[model samples]
Target chain A: MPRTSDGRERLIEAGVELFSQRPYGSIGVAELCTRAGVNKGSFYYFFASKEALALAVIDRHWTWQKGVWAGILDGSGSLLDRLRGLFDATAQMQVDAVTGTGWVAGCLFGNLALEVSSQNEPVRLRLQEIFDEQIAMIASRLASAVESGELQSVADVDGAAKAIVAQLEGLVLFAKVFNDPSQLDALWQNSLALLGLAPARA
Target chain B: MPRTSDGRERLIEAGVELFSQRPYGSIGVAELCTRAGVNKGSFYYFFASKEALALAVIDRHWTWQKGVWAGILDGSGSLLDRLRGLFDATAQMQVDAVTGTGWVAGCLFGNLALEVSSQNEPVRLRLQEIFDEQIAMIASRLASAVESGELQSVADVDGAAKAIVAQLEGLVLFAKVFNDPSQLDALWQNSLALLGLAPARA
Candidate 1:
């Protein structure tokens, strides 16, 4: 038999899965508890309410994603390599043959941003901050490229960085809806071309 | 004392407002019916079920948007003018005043594409088709520009078109989350620059 702490961890795990799979509002505490294989008492012991559990799940997701990005950006590789690594890693997580079936699940942040952010003020502000941080991180990378003379010095580094991230987000949306990884490939190619990093072909 | 037919339109009107304001799952059928000022029987009479009503609302949204695009594309104007006109129209709809409220209700298809598509096959397929049609329309416009030689001949028209639409969608997502229309302005300017059109000076 699992300990009480194990049950709490299971509840958080189930919440993440459910929130990712469906709209947060659609899933109930009872269903989440059932999925976690824990009783209501255990659920209450771990979190104040379903909303608190959701907040915890979101915090965990943000932390994990930040770690992934940090690992990629901190890698001993070219900037282009770091960008590609980020895309490839995200594509793998989002495009699973078993769960994906015929449809891509899109980015968890992107999905939640669309669904919950408008009505949920806290979530909206948090997502905005997260996006700003992401843009800044990408901008820093682009600035490095500019300093290295890989990219034009006159290039609108901030604008270009924003465009790259925007295009990536768009690619995620298209890939999810179209269920085609090639859309992401095109996005990567076009972005590289825009950045003057794509290899020239005869 | 309104006619029964009025009830149907009323329900749809309420649906558009509520669904666009929040997630589909967050809005209850009972609340929707009350907002429409119609009983459950009238609601059922107009639509088979809640899902059916949602489909109807989606169809209505698609039809209205197609009309807007048609008006923009079919106008007797230069491609640049048309593009600017489209951006201006969108900005007008999205910009908020001192009160900080505007038409930045977000895209219904985008919201649903994120939340419902993964779980609902019917909605997914329908949204997918809508997205494909949107991409096709933009591609056709770019094809015209390519023929006119306004854009570089070597440019990949289809890819450019997809990227433009992707940026627009991403811009909308950002606008919704941040409740700021300035992001759309950046997107519009960057898009025009990408297309080699002179961006309107701020």
Candidate 2:
């Protein structure tokens, strides 16, 4: 009885919810269909396989996350302020997940990146691209910070960006494992340190 | 028949191998038993469940890893030198795994922390303790580094230790996802930055 196109969207929503909540290997297509209120026929009608649906969920998540990152990173004050804004938002999402779902939904990409990267090549390739973009975004901002005189200069700007992003993923793991968002409180100071800037300025 | 205790060790070995190679949810007791060359009866005799076997595997892995960490960190030259030693060993393990298994076997605790931390309570608690001990070990080293005048002082020794560990975990995630041990090359410089020290000495 649902709209024809609703099936595809619902499948992705279910994929996001289920994948984020548990390991990717544990989630089944039948369960995905049930959660989406789409029958098996409709499920197959949209996605060639569960992997296809997972790729869709991944694309959808990146699209939304990319928008949020662009909005904050683009509309920001100083580079530190904008980066702080991004970290604040990142921490808040974990808090929100705990409040809403009673579980800290860790970084969906990072979670999948670890869970499926070795077993699933398509998923792994997509995740690699996603992480690369994340690093590039931060690297671009750091370059601007140096140009604007907020930073003296960065040696190996891309490496710094990768380190910052790596730190974020690591803290997010702690947040998920410890079930504590405050674990992320160090992001601002640590980000400053990585950039060779004093936190007194932050 | 094999030695009476070999079954237990074999099961734990299989857990380490299979669990690291794929998501935990997809690996079942039967697969573990077959891989260990232990029959079904012997498996239940050794482990109450797959999760139980996983915990045993975790303990064994930590036992070996903690020894390596303590051996490097507890001995050697400056804090920077020891930390570099630890990072090099960590990267080398991934390299070895790639050479032997054609896949990076990321930190077992970290991989499971993200995968089963929410779903399995006992495993979650054990992992929490392991990570806390890891943080504690590094914090103790940083404290000694300060006492010995390696640097002026550390503002938040524990926080810095946690950040360094987090950065390590983040970079490990990259190493696993990107399938490159070189991703961890940032550990030494980034650890210095986190500690409010310069990397020129590193």
Candidate 3:
């Protein structure tokens, strides 16, 4: 049996899979242990409690997602193209998920934000920090866009960034509710419009 | 003790309270029974299972919400003013909730759409139907806006309406996450901009 740190890795892997596919409240640690192929005792040996494990899972998931967003947002291209790339990446991920799982698993941060934020204070506070970090990154990119003249100046850049992130999350929720990944199709245009951007030069 | 239909009403009322405050999977029928002041037998008499009761709760919630939306959207006012009225009502309700409970409980439909949409098929389908109804109503109002020349015609009226609803839900999610009711303040402007409307005539 995997012991200690190895057991922790396997448990978090299982958690990301199960939690992303279903609501946090619906999933129990027993299923997580079973899925991870670890015993219940091993599960507790690694984490303090289910909510503790959830906090860990949030950290793990955000690390992976931030890398993905970085690859899209931080890569070489025009700012508009890069932002569009981020939307494309999001849409492609949804497409892949629907192709593989027949369901669009929305963003996990957003999942927890709506589902458990009110019930779990620690998790909600962590999620708030993550959201603030994300909005700041997006605000930096928006500031770059304004500096490069790709977009006009926004009144409140962070506020606009928050709106963009919120809309992206909302579209993902729409995709999940409708079970149609194509619901993400309008993200690039809508996001640009939300930021008051002009049509990007081809 | 409430009997028959009265018991059902009480159970649904309790469901709306608890589920909106917490989550569906975290809430149990026994607790629901306790909250409703009814017995487990009476609860089982109305709902075959907790999920069934959730379905009833969704129905009841939507009926009440649709009335609220109608009062804002269908009542006498300009389309822009009516739209602004909808946002105002939403913010006021969140303010009221935060003041009453110190927690900003987001939209129940939106909460369930994220939490249970993947795990429960019936509830997801019902939510999809409810969202379609909402988007259609918003689209009709958008159409009226185009006819009245309050705004230019949108290429995709339904899509624009969906965007508006998505942003509204997003703002509510932001509110819940930040534990700040002011997060809903941007809905009026963001939504109008989404619909391709000029600054609303003050």
Candidate 4:
């Protein structure tokens, strides 16, 4: 079994699992403590309140996603390949994570954004920051493609990047709702086609 | 102001607001009663429990959405025009509803699907049924287009319909996150383009 000596780490792991299962507001401190295998005192010692623990969970997700973006952006390939790689990697990660949990609960950030964006300003702002960062990353990559003369000058880099993000996020939601991996495949092909880069089918 | 004579209508209206603002599990019966301005007895008289109230809310939303679908399906115009009209109408409804609510809460069924799909089988099944109905409606429309030679038979009607539904729901989630209406415009145009329909801008 996996183990953690630090109360903060334990709390975060428990928070991710529970929050992904249900909304953060529905999770109580007692249940969190029990899941983390820590007493209430230890939980309090690590986080001041349930909201704080939820924030830590969001931070953990952000950190992991940033690492994912880094991989996609750093790969030495055509811009379209890199973009397709991002979607493929996301599909694999989602399948692995959901399979391990024995249920497909969808993207945690997307799920939380739907539930709390209107109700909590702090959470909403944080989610926006993450989304903005993602958009900028895609924009930067596309801008580089434009600078290299690989893409048309009138390609509308910002617009294309935003659409790409929207479509990718949209496809993830579809995958979750339908519980089908082929939906992701269809989306992957459509996205690449939108970018004018789908591979020839055999 | 609009008015309802019975307690059940009030409870459902309150539920539409509260449940959309947050997850069903997070909102309590007392809070819903307070928001609806009805007593616990009245709430119970109308519905047996919170879950029953949630089911009622879902049923109401499904009923209302069916009306929207009928408007598009029954319209006399080119298939492309009818599809664009559907998106245009939906966008207007979203803007009007957001202004009336003074907040940017998204679709209640979507919020519920994300929150309860993994943990609650009944809710998941209900959501799946609604989704299936939506796909069927779109597929039937596309079939008409195929008959008229507006779209090629090479097009997978079911796949295209599912993609459109995914785009619409995804667009709503993105719109909520960005707090912008322009995202809906992008979704509207791109989704039509994918369907081989005339672009919304055109």
> Taking candidate 1, what TM-score does its chain B reach relative to the real chain B?
0.86
* Candidate 4: regions farther than 4 A off: A1-5, A149-154, A196-202, B1-6, B34-48, B152-154, B196-202
Please give the ranking of all candidate structures by DockQ, highest first, separated by commas: 2, 3, 1, 4
For each candidate, what is chain B's TM-score?
0.86, 0.95, 0.94, 0.87
Candidate 2: give the clashing pairs. Answer: none
lDDT for each residue of candidate 3 in A17-133, tens digit (9 for 90 to 100): 888888898889899999999999999999989999999999999899889888878899888788888888888888888788888988888989999888899999999999888
Residue-level lDDT of model 4, residues A156-191, one tens digit each, is 666556666776666666666666544577666555
lDDT of 2 at B11: 90
lDDT of 2 by residue, A102-178 (tens): 77889999999888888898998999999999999988988888788887647677888898999999999988898
> How many Å off is the CA of A114 in candidate 1?
0.8
- Candidate 1 CAPRI-style tier: acceptable
**Model 1 over residues B1-202: C-alpha lDDT tens digits?**
3448989888888887788777898888899999999988788888887788888788888898898887997687877678767777766666643134443677788888888876777877888889878878877887787788765432666666676778877888888778876777776655654453432121
Candidate 3 global TM-score: 0.95
Interface RMSD after interface superposition, each candidate = 4.5, 3.2, 4.2, 4.3
RMSD values, in order shown: 3.3, 2.1, 2.6, 4.2
* lDDT score at residue B29, model 3, on the 0-100 scale: 88
Ten contiguous residues minimizing lDDT sum, candidate 1 chain A: A193-202
Q: Clashes in model 3: which pairs?
A: none
In angstroms, the error of model 1 at B132 is 1.5
Between prediction 1 and prediction 2, the one with superior DockQ is: 2
Candidate 2 lDDT by residue in tens digits, B1-202? 4537988998999998898888888899999988989898898888888888988999998998899999999886988899889999999999999999888888888899888877998998898899999999999998888788885547678888898999999999999899888888889888877887752122
Docking class of 3: medium
